[model samples]
Target: MTETKELSRLKLLAKRYARANRIAQHQALDLVAGELGFPNWNKLISVSKKGWLADSVQMASIEAFVTRALPAAIFRDGDPEAMARRFAHLEQAERGMIGDHTYRLQEILHEVIIAGEGWSIRIPENPGAIPIVETFTNQERECPALEPEFLQKALELARDRAVQVRAEISADWPRRSTKPDQSGMVRHPLCRGESDVWFCLHCDGKITSAQIAQNLWHCPACGASPLDIFDTAFWSDDKGESFLPVKTDGSTDRDELDFRIVDSRPKLDLTEEKIILLIRSALLDDATNISEKLGALQAEISVDDENGVWIIIEEDLWPEGKDPVQALAVAKLLGLEVERLSSWSTIPFAWPRLGEIASSTCDYTQMMLDAYAQYGGSPTK
Candidate 1:
């Protein structure tokens, strides 16, 4: 088809779409006004219609108005001529012309309004208004020449100074983990290896050396603390090659905590309490508040310290009786958190006869045998 014919057809389509849009917009305005119990629906409809076509309307504001009001107007049954006139006014107001560009713009606007459901025209808040394109002109100026190496060194020095300034500013922030000295070396209790040190992972509170041991690593500033690390078990080969358990109060013979039930039936008896206790103990000398909260089945609690308050949660506290879905629901109700185990079966066994062999073994496999016996099954073949 010739360009003139094509353009005319496109203009016709644009007019049709625009007319439909205005009717829907007016209908929606009436409905909303009625729902809001407005006394005069015609006044609201008039305001909305006029507002969209006002020359003073910001690009962002107009886009938003069209997005919401146009699609609904297009879908409603109405007088096409009146709708066309309203849209023509809008198009003229928006683009200041009624040419091919205006028609294409209308079509684009219609498609976006109908398909995008008002989201496409939403202005992002962070960057504020979109930037306008601008041309940059470079003006030539004479400058004194410097040695290439000297220029390179000067650039490097400037970069280093900028980095130092940023680092200093960041260090002053409450949650900073490291502070830089004049030499640009970051210094913190974790790096210093103070025997008594308390540091909060979530905030900027740290005490070094004996203080850490005394405070149990609880951040006095942020009230953030570390979880206790416990040596639950030690595994070794038959040749007496064994890994040393982490020393807690110089005790080496403490029995390993059991994570499974005696009868091998999954139960809540081996609860997550022990893990929470361990974390608390490791991070704080006196975790009385945390202990009390745990006792009450509260999974999460906020504590205050010198730096700030910290929100801590027992990340593994789902009741044993609930299935995954139910557990999730309970967690939401209690505002608790859940952590899934990496593996479904916590018990590690060797190969194809893993469970079968575990059921029969004694000595090294005493726990499994005990569980089997509890279930009224013999541990031995």
Candidate 2:
């Protein structure tokens, strides 16, 4: 018999992780259960009631494995409780294999699971790339899931949770099989070198014959789909059965796949350069006879690491020196980050025939507002 109960060992492991990550011991336990194939601590206990007891030393060993295996969710907000609330809805880890690729259900950030890489958010500089933490050796798969995908998934999960009155599986429900990890898979026709080793047609990389199959013929390195998977290099144009489809039982359990596709949420590819062009176009819209003028004024825009977008236009755009200010206000209304490279105080302009001077930036702003108010316009939206 083991020295301590397995549940107790899990409890202990949770406490240790909680201490290490500075999260609550309970949330830590949930994270641990998620690390395992359970949705929560209670679920794990319920499922493993027969094997509640285990060796404490062995439990420690498993914890060691977890330390190396699991990616620590760095709660940067510094509040352990905040971390708990943030990840409160994350379901327990479910063991499922796609083709030959194995995955555990873990929330990366909201809906994004770094898949085999543990829970991690992509470093923002590479919004379109998967979060690939290079230090971990056993886990080195990247995917197409990016920042927009993350947001989309999170929203879907939230919406699903709201409508999910209960958690029961149905025949029509799009879910993985009971023992998702054990789902049947087939080897790719194009990448097979040996019986068990294979090549990734998309990356020109190698994969464990089991891996590419398990990953649903998706390239773990470059996130290629099954369409790109091939059995051979078709060496020497032999035109063999390399292009022919090899029949298989079916796909790996795709729990998140159906959920993620609910909205074909395309990547929000609005880059800084694009934002500048958009702002310039909007500015032209806001001012009368300013399209060619603003276009002539050389626009420069930038987005900082902190997500502030800076815009620079010629000084002559606003004789009253409010061009960037007006643009900033517009950007703010749109919840955009915009900065000005060159700014100036008012150089008042005389009204036609009248001596009324729009001297200050505020005056020019009010003038535009009054004009808009008279002309029935909605500028802020």
**Most TM-score-accurate candidate:** 2
Model 1: per-residue Cα lDDT at residue 144: 13
lDDT of each: 0.29, 0.43
Q: After superposition, how far is residue 220 of candidate 2 from its true place, in Å?
A: 9.4
Q: What is the lDDT of residue 63 in candidate 1?
A: 34
Tens-digit lDDT string for candidate 1 (60-150): 3333333322222233443446445444444343222222112111123111110011111211111111211111222242111122332
TM-score of 2: 0.26
Once fitted onto the true fold, the runs of candidate 2 whose alpha carbons sit more than 4 angstroms away are 1-198, 203-278, 290-297, 303-311, 315-326, 334-381
lDDT of 2 by residue, 1-381 (tens): 343466766787676554333234567777667656567778877767666444556566557633421112232223446334334433423344433434444332223332433232222111112333212222254332333455345333332222111111111122221112233333333333223433445555544444554343456556665566555554425433243322322233222323222222244677766766767766655454332244324456666767677765545443445454456665776577766665442323222211134454465567766765776566664
Q: Highest lDDT: which candidate?
A: 2
RMSD of each: 32.2, 19.2
Off by over 4 Å in 1: 1-90, 93-130, 136-381
